[model samples]
Target: MAYRDQWKMLHLLNTSMRGALKETELIEMGIDCYPDTIQYLKDDGIVEMDGTGVYSLNPMVRRMLNKFMIAMGAGDMKEIYVDVPSCFIVMPFSEEWSDTVFYDFIQPAVIKSKMECVRGDMIPRVGKLSENIVKQIQRTGLVIADISVPNANVFYELGIADAIGRDVFLLYEKNIEQNLPADIQGAHYYAYDRNNIPESVERFAESLIQWKELYRVDVTLKYCRK
Candidate 1:
């Protein structure tokens, strides 16, 4: 762990795609990056300067860091303060179809893509249901919205995800694609058949993998003082 401080900095920077780490902010995290460590990182090409005194992880290096974290196990990263990426599912709950779609299709697909999958109903109630949903949407890196039955709550949740700029993946039953609201008719979606569970899950998983790589989910991690 000769470069443990640098490792910690990269883990934190890789957590978000948003902005760079300013030199002053590094001091707040108790990181010594003024000249020596920052020069070490620049020489290695692991990070790039966004401006005069700000730096962010290089895109390719970020991907490598993600792979390293995965290989080392998410739990191991948590021990070092890295946040795990997660996908939240937005769908109508307590319906017969809900169980089928979540278990048979969505959950498996999310698992295949190496991310945690959670839904509104799955979380323990803390305050209002709407409030919890909003919190989860904001916390998650990606959102998967199922608009198969035109449920009002689902639509509202989907709108929140959109407003907050989370990476969203729309899904629907093939039969209802034509009946979807005109507002979202132009949006891209995956239509699955009820009878084709396994195949649909595979296709959805593959598509999700490709989409994640292209968009690079928005994730954030803050340095916690020990």
Candidate 2:
């Protein structure tokens, strides 16, 4: 298969809204539906079409392609598609806390590590918010979850991130680090001080850089074949 075809197919698969796109939509989006490329994927069962001419990627094939790309040690896969490595923060959101914890603390640290920082509520989607949250969690390279307060929704998001084997970094306020749930007692986490915001963020950025290095090492070691 041509590399351009693969790239075009992958791009279309991700950019399609509502999980499928008609050929006209592809053209409007400036993507050409090369007949040979489409036919190749169709013959291989990698792409599907409906009676009305909407195209969708086969889910299983998409999964296999993603895993193969990852296993080939294409860290972040930027060459194949335009994407900035992003970190999805699973945390309790409130007006004050969003500013204090996320905007001030986590966002700077994530930016310092050269990644986009996003939260579940920050993403815009036209579906159930929960489904959007799951999709964001799946797309991100790292998950930073603030378990400072025992909110059920925070823990629920954390569970979803954990269940899907995301690289999670937990954070909590200074004194409550020891009070985390038993299930995540052994997980990686950091404690931050609210009063010492600047210093705390500096320390968090340092840790985040180290975490990114460790994450890269882990992925390369686990997936890169000798």
Candidate 3:
């Protein structure tokens, strides 16, 4: 099977509710020799099938396809089917500082907003750090960045999130002088301190809910206009 045909098959499976496909269904969609294509996809670890011929996309491949669709501005399809919004945290990876923020503020706040929160350190270090970070960022619906320190890795990840138009929330430790770069100087950020963590968590959750509502409205309007 040609590469394009394989893509079509994968796309169909991806957009389906259960990510399940049958040989007959593929043929009905005008795929020629779909069994061979399915075999090819299986060989590439892109899909898996049962003994009953019900095929489904591999979880990793499905996530990659979702990210691709988002990057391509296919927001309508992606938003409509997304089960849970994910927020990626970009912060300096330090045991003391990162753990305190993650457990005390970030995790609780995001869970309260009913969204999943993931950080770079949570991911398995199986590949290039830069590539892995960007891939995780691409898959998220939003980004929460902590710029309390002048961390290069955090800044780089934040840039990728910004370029992709992901809704972002900046955070900083209170009383620290923030010399934000020109690109993000005008952006609003939440300030927190150890003394006011509970209050900050409440505010952060509220802010995320508001941001998510606004994002949904914006996406809806854009798609309607098109």
Off by over 4 Å in 2: 1-84, 217-226
Superposed Cα RMSD, model 3: 12.5
Candidate 1 — which residues are off by over 4 angstroms? 1-53, 56-84, 217-226
- lDDT against the true structure, per candidate, is 0.68, 0.66, 0.68
Q: lDDT by residue for model 3 over 90-164, one digit each (tens)? A: 888784677888889988998888777887778757556666666666557678888888888888887776664
Q: What is the lDDT of candidate 3?
A: 0.68
Worst 10 residues of 1 by lDDT: 71-80
- On residues 1-226, what C-alpha lDDT tens digit does candidate 1 reach at each position? 2264576467556554454677666655445544666778888898898658787988888766555433222222322223235788888876789899999889999999888898777876865666666667755767788888878888888877665445677888998777877776434588998899999999999987775554332222343221
Evaluate residue 186 in candidate 3 and report its C-alpha lDDT on the 0 to 100 scale: 36
Candidate 1: the clashing residue pairs are: none
Model 1, C-alpha of 35: deviation from truth (Å): 26
Task: Return the lDDT, model 3, position 152.
Answer: 82
